[model samples]
Target: MRIVVVGGGYAGVLAANRLAKAVEAEITVVNPRPDFVERVRLHQQVAGTAVAAGPLGSMLRAGIATRVAAAHKVGDGTVTLDDGSTLDFDYALLAVGSTVEPMAGTVPIGSWEGAQRARAALAALPAGAVVAVVGGGATGVETAAEVAAARPDLRVRIVGSPVAATFTGRARRLVRDGLARVGVEVTDDEVVAVDGGDVALASGTGFAADLVLWAIVSGVPELAAASGLDVDADGRVLVDEFLRSTSDERVFAIGDCAGVPGTRFACQSATDQAGHAASALAAMIAGRGPKPYSVRYLARCVTLGRRAAVAQFTHLDDTPRDTALSGRTAAVLKELATRGAKFGARAGFGA
Candidate 1:
């Protein structure tokens, strides 16, 4: 069987790697970039602590084919790329993930190049200067913490909307409390605009900042829409409980790209989806029909600088329980998780 995967982000790459070992089927991955981005560590890239790019060829297994171009469309069983390329397959998995959203007057930082500029731009700020990070979601929280930890000179302020209300129990408390204790200025008010190193608050208050990082409005690739696949209003592929797209049974979606009900977009969730897809594909290769996707998360860890963090271990029901740890202990957990991300690098590159 010939299987094709599109957009080698978290979901796509993981699916490709797992399926590579699962079957003797020919596999092809179509992605615009040559390297697999460590998207979870992108905030560190924005903070200038990590090099932004790694070659894609280094990440793939020996048998999988890699295409270095944007997927322009999907026709029949083929995925069309930006440079007039078409790839056909018997089975397809869509893992086109989301992109960052820019706030008022602020350019979004998503890609490595954009994040590099953002890091340099912030670097130019005077010592002990104030920086504004809008959005209180996981990305925003991680960005704020990474900036504070990586560069102690800058004052970090997080402006969040009531949507911050979405996070509950231990996870919510952990993030908010972690930010507060670590010197992040938590503002509940909305942002009205960003201009001339000043963040305008919805309450008509203007706060001066050395740099403004917009971490809201994360979006997805438009390839699903272009490919004539049915997409939700948010650009996510609507998938069934089994992670197969309802519009095309030959197509499957997962990770941040798959709009799984009641699931938040996070790397842990993507990893869980990756595991799910791995089993399903193994089933398919073993001469059984493809099984549906399922997800279960173990823990959620967010760093507060390098010394402190909030670890929320959860049950299968999504009920979060607190496992707060700080100092060297928490630092080790954060480092371990970061190292876990490196596993994908190995799966792609193969030691």
Candidate 2:
């Protein structure tokens, strides 16, 4: 069997590695870059404190071929690359992830390249310049705190709704406090429009900043929809319990691109779904029954720069619990998890 994985993100790398070990199929991974990016650390990268994750060749298991090209189309048993080349496969795994929804005149910390651009823009700005992060979600909160900590002279503010609405109890309070401890201001408002050096909020408030980083929302590309695959309204591919596309049994979807009910757009779900897809494919290849993907939410870790963090414990369904790990312990745990994610991908599936 020949399997083609159309991405090199967390999900794609894990899925490709698992499949290579589970079966005798020839596996090929097509990605735009030859190196693996630690997306979870993009905020740190923007703050100029990112660790190296090595290249894609070192992470993927041996015998799995890789092509440095973007996948433009996915057809039955085939994938077309941007270079006008096509690869034939018995099955295809669509792990193409999502990106930040772009807003006018604002830099978003979504992709690796975008984060680098934001970093350069921040470094070029003069000291004492005001920097506004337009969002109160995890990414926004983390970015605001990181920027404030990295450049104390620069005024950093987080402009958005309640910080980490999904996190309640102590976790929510800790996130707010962590930001405050780092001299980051949290503003409870919505940004309506972004113009030159100014952001208009829904509360009739305008914040003029030297630079604005928007992390309000994310969006998936049109690759799956254009290829006639079943997707949700947001272009997220719909998948069954086994992580296989409901419309095309020969295709599997994972990561932020797969619409897994009750699962947030997180790296944890991506790795879990990748493992499920690999096992399901192996079961099918062995003429055995495949099991459904079972995912459980444990904790959500958000680092407040490098000094502090909040590891919010969650219920199985992702609802926050009253308990949490905070301060240096949480920061250390977060760092370990971040490092583990990067190196684990290089260790192959089930490592």
Candidate 3:
């Protein structure tokens, strides 16, 4: 069997590695870059505190081929690369992951490329400069705290919707306290415009920013839609219970690009989905029916710099619970979880 996996983000890498071990197939992973990006640690990269990427070859298991090119199109039983090369396959996995396009005047820290740009821009700024982070989700809060902790001299503030809005009331309070402990000012005002280093708020208030970082994820790649696959309104490929594309049984979609209901855009979910897809694919190749994919929510961990964090326990369906952990212990768990994610991807133990 010949299998081609597109994209090498958390989902793509984990799926490729798991598939390599689960089935007897010639696996080839197509990625735009030669390295695997640890997207969960991108905030650290922007703060100059950690390196989040390594050679892709080093992460994948032996006998799996790597193509350092973007996937231009994924057709039936074939994948077309950006350089006009084509690879024929019996099956394909579309795991292109998510993307973020910052506004004209803002830098983004969502993708590997954006993280590098943010790092350079942040490094060039002088001390006492105002750094405004737009968005109040996990990425936004993490980026604000990371930058504030790494460069205490800089004035860093996170402005947007409520910070950590997904967490429960107790967990949200913990996150707010953690942010305050790290000297990050939290704002609930919506940003209406970003122009010429000035951020205009919806309430008619504005502030001069020396640097602006956008932490919101905009959308996924257009490859699935462009290839005529059945995608949701957000352009994520719609998949059935088995993670196989609805329109093409030969293709499976997982991770951020897969329109799987109840799943969030996190490496934990991606790896978990990859593990299930591997098992399902293996079963299908063995002339047996594969089980439907399902995931149980464990906990959500958000790092507030290097010293503090908040871990919100969740029900099986991902709804937050009052039971939570905070401070150093939570930070340690967050670190362990991140390391475990990398190890799981490398060892093909995602399931």
Best by lDDT: 3
Put down candidate 2 lDDT per residue, 1-351, tens digits, no spaces.
Answer: 999998898888988988888899999999899988888888888888774335888888989999999988898878988899899988999888887876898898878777888999999988989998988888898899888999999999998777777678888888899999999988888888888987898989897999999875578878899889999988999999888889999999988899888888887877878878888998999999998887677799899999999998888888777889999999999999877776666665532
Tell me the spans in candidate 1 whose CA falls farther than 4 Å from its real position. 162-174, 348-351
Per-model TM values vs. the true structure: 0.90, 0.97, 0.98
Please give the distance, in angstroms, between residue 56's alpha carbon in candidate 2 and its true position after superposition.
1.1
Clashes of 1: 5
Go through the candidates in order and give the clash count of each: 5, 0, 0
Best by TM-score: 3
Error of 2 at 134 (Å): 1.1
TM-score of 1: 0.90
User: In candidate 1, what are the lDDT values of residues 123-215, reduced to their tens digit?
Assistant: 888888988888876667878877877777779888887423545675577578778777788888888888888788888897888788877
Ranking of candidates on lDDT, top first: 3, 2, 1
Worst 10 residues of 2 by lDDT: 342-351
Lowest lDDT 10-mer window, candidate 3? 160-169
lDDT of 3: 0.91
Stretches of candidate 3 exceeding 4 Å from the true structure: none
